[model samples]
Target: MLTAYLTHPDCERHQMGADHPECPERLAALRDHLLVKGLLDCMQEHEAPAASDEQLQRVHDRAWLLQLADQVPAEGYARLDADTLINPYTLRAARRAAGAAVRAVDLVLGGQAPNAFCAVRPPGHHAQRAQGAGFCFFNNAAVGVAHALAAHGLLRVALVDFDVHHGDGSEDIFAGDERVLLCSSYQQDLYPFRDSHPPAANVVLAPLAARSGGAAMREAVTQYWLPALARFAPELIVVSAGFDAHREDDMGNLGWSEADYRWLTEQVLAQAQASAGGRIVSCLEGGYALSALARSAAAHLRVLVEA
Candidate 1:
């Protein structure tokens, strides 16, 4: 089966202020790059739907979500935090971004696709169960994991985050949840800083030093993530695929390149093939530098389709 590519126009509407790096151009760049590289032609495409309140509740507290919805601005921007802002369409866009992951999960698990990539934005790794940060309003990957567990009765789901910054929100939501194993490699001393020690047994937080390059990331995945993932033998695999670590991206100092993204996808594909019927639902989490994000995402999608 062909891989699925999911995105939405609403994602472009959830923009922060003009100077922010997580701008709408990120999505536009990815779309343009995939088209230019002929990557879009190899996959089935779908526009993301708005997530139901029920699905949002699986990963967010209902009251917190209600408060966020109530705070959305009609004409201007409302600041959720120092870095996160909500425009009139922000909440709807966040729901749609989260829904993209949920739908990708449904599609992959149902055998409609071998794997899927969500190209939506307002990146989700920094959004916690009850808090939003780092331009993230909803925990999209967490929402997808919850859907796989609740809807498909998945026993064990593995979440692998390769963002430059730690996936603190995902750690918060899945902490102590025995059914899920969370493995990640992030730049040390970065945003949402405290993930060196996860509060749960299933979390393997590998923080690499700045300028460590892709070799360090690859080593951590091979030595730590792979073993933990193999032991868990998950029924489904979820990826918080962030390309901010690229060398061209000033978002972080990991110095990764497009080849690194492709290599990482290959590793994840191996784990999925071994235990999960090659099922993977990757949600875009972070990537700011327009050109690098586009190239890295294209490399990742190429592997997701070819593998």
Candidate 2:
């Protein structure tokens, strides 16, 4: 089976404004880099579908979800937060982003693919069940986790977030859900500033200090995430794969490199091979610097595809 690459053009349509770090150019840069590196040739590609109301309701509140739809403007942008907004295409793009994660899960679980990566954006992980922030509109990976648990009757699913910021939104949705284990690593001083916080019983944390290097992240993950994952023995692994922690990306100060991303992907992929029949669904989260994002995502994809 091949690794699946999922993306949508609408993802590029959901932009904040000119020169924003999370600009629409991110998808283009990533895609072009993957193409240049020949990573795209190794995977089976698919266009992301729009997530239904029923699908998104698994992780988001119905009222807030509806409000997101109602807030879409005809030509101008609508505000969910100072950093998050909805242009004419933001809602559709958000649905596509969420839907890509769900589709990746379905493809992996249904035996059509061994693993998958979603390249859609309006990057998630900051959108809580009832609120949106940090440029996130919907908790994409959380939606997928909920789908695997609720729709596929999966008893154990691990959601691993290695973004530069804590996956507080994901934690908020799955805090009390025992069937899922959420593991997160983030720079403590970045935006959202959810550093050194206590996680739920099912949530494992590996908070890295500002300017901490990859060794620190590796140590934290080894000390916390790996053991919990071994104990839980998840049936599927869902990843919030973000690259902003890279030293080149100024989104945070973790100072990681592309090799660190490859190492992280290796850990997740190895665990999937051991306990999940190689079932994995990884979704794009935060990676700001275009060059770093492209290089890091390519490095991450090489592991999943070549595995």
Candidate 3:
């Protein structure tokens, strides 16, 4: 079966501001690049369905979810934090972005697709179980992992994050859960900077210094992530794919290029093949520079399709 590509038009409508780096144009740029590179042809496309309340509750608190729903504005934006704001369409887009991950998991585990890539915006890795932060509302990758375990009845799962910033929100929800192993590599001193001492054994936090190049990241994956993941023997693997660490992106000092994204994806694919039945659900998280985000996301998607 081909890989499934899940997205929705509403994902672009959830905007924080006109000047925000995490704008809707990132998704547009990625889609255009994928089409131009002929990467879309090898995949099966599907529109993401709105996530059900029950599915969302598996990873997020119901009270927080309702609070977000109640806070949605009729015309303007509502501030959740200093960096996170919800516009009129923000609520719908957040649900769709999260729903894309859940649907990707379903497609991969239900045998409809060999693997899946979710290309939605309002990127979710920073959103905690009870609060939204870092331009994310619902933790998409966390929601997907929960869906695989709860709905699909899969016990062993893994989440791999390669964003420039620590996925503290994801770690917050999955810490101490032995059933899932979380492997992440991010810049050492960035937003929500607290992964230096990862709180759990299941979480392999590879905190790199500023300006750390792709080689350093590769070393972390080879030394830290590979060993832990191999022992887990997960039934499925979910990726919180973020491209903001690219050299061109000013979001962080990490100089990761498109090749790094491709190499890392291939490494994850190898692990998935060995222990997870080749199942993968990748969701978009962070990437600021438009050109770099487009190219990097394309590279990641290419590996998903070919592998």
Indicate the worst ten consecutive residues by lDDT in candidate 2: 191-200
TM-scores of all candidate predictions against the true structure:
0.98, 0.98, 0.99
User: Tens digits of per-residue lDDT for model 1 on 70-159?
Assistant: 999888899888888889989989999999999999999999999999999878988888888888989999999999999999999999
**Model 2 lDDT, residue 202, Cα:** 91
Q: Could you tell me the TM-score of candidate 2?
A: 0.98
What lDDT score goes with residue 56 in model 3?
A: 88
lDDT of 3 at 239: 95
* Position 67, candidate 2: lDDT: 86
| Clashing pairs for predicted structure model 2, backbone only | none
Clashing pairs in 1: none
Q: Residue 7, candidate 1: how far off, in angstroms?
A: 0.8
Q: Estimate the TM-score for candidate 1.
A: 0.98
The numbered model that scores best in lDDT is: 3
Name the 10 consecutive residues with the lowest summed lDDT in model 1.
191-200
The better candidate by lDDT, 1 or 3, is: 3
Report the lDDT tens digits of candidate 2 across residue range 179-212: 9999999988677877466666998888788887
lDDT of each: 0.92, 0.91, 0.92
